[model samples]
Target: MNQSSTPQVPFWAHLLCGWPLFLVAVGGAVGGGLGGLAYGISISIFKTNVPMPVKIIAPVFIGMAAVVLYFVIAVAIFTAIQ
Candidate 1:
């Protein structure tokens, strides 16, 4: 096989500097928003009386991390399965 002269870019580099960031950002936003709302609702239902801002923010951060970080992994798994 003939090797190409051009160097290949790393996945991390692409993630940081290329199109993947967009996917991550979108995923993070959507996930974070829904997570926040869900958390707030659950808390209200439980009647724990936690502050709304705190409850929402904490879950938002977690949800953002979950969806944002998983986008790439999901794609990798999909490719591997194929």
Candidate 2:
């Protein structure tokens, strides 16, 4: 019996291999952002003291940050697996 070693691919290859996972991460970010935005808008509309613009903007920033964090985490996990 003969066995050959598996080929070593680049980091980008690893990322591509995990594309579905990446998509999930993106979905999570979008869902979180939309939820936060909705909550913020609701609060702004219903509450008297809070500013509407801040409410709308903060969630967008948070959402972008969350997406970045998700990518970092996904890369870390992929690296660990490798």
| Model 2: residues with Cα > 4 Å off, grouped in runs | 1-48
Best by TM-score: 2
The segments of candidate 1 whose C-alpha lies over 4 angstroms from its true place after superposition are 1-47
**Number of backbone-clashing residue pairs for each candidate, in the order shown:** 0, 0
Tens digits of per-residue lDDT for model 2, 1-82? 7655543334543332222333343557544554445444433333344465754455445445545765677688779999
Report lDDT (CA) for all predictions. 0.47, 0.48
- The pairs that clash in candidate 1 are none
List the candidates' TM-scores in order: 0.31, 0.44
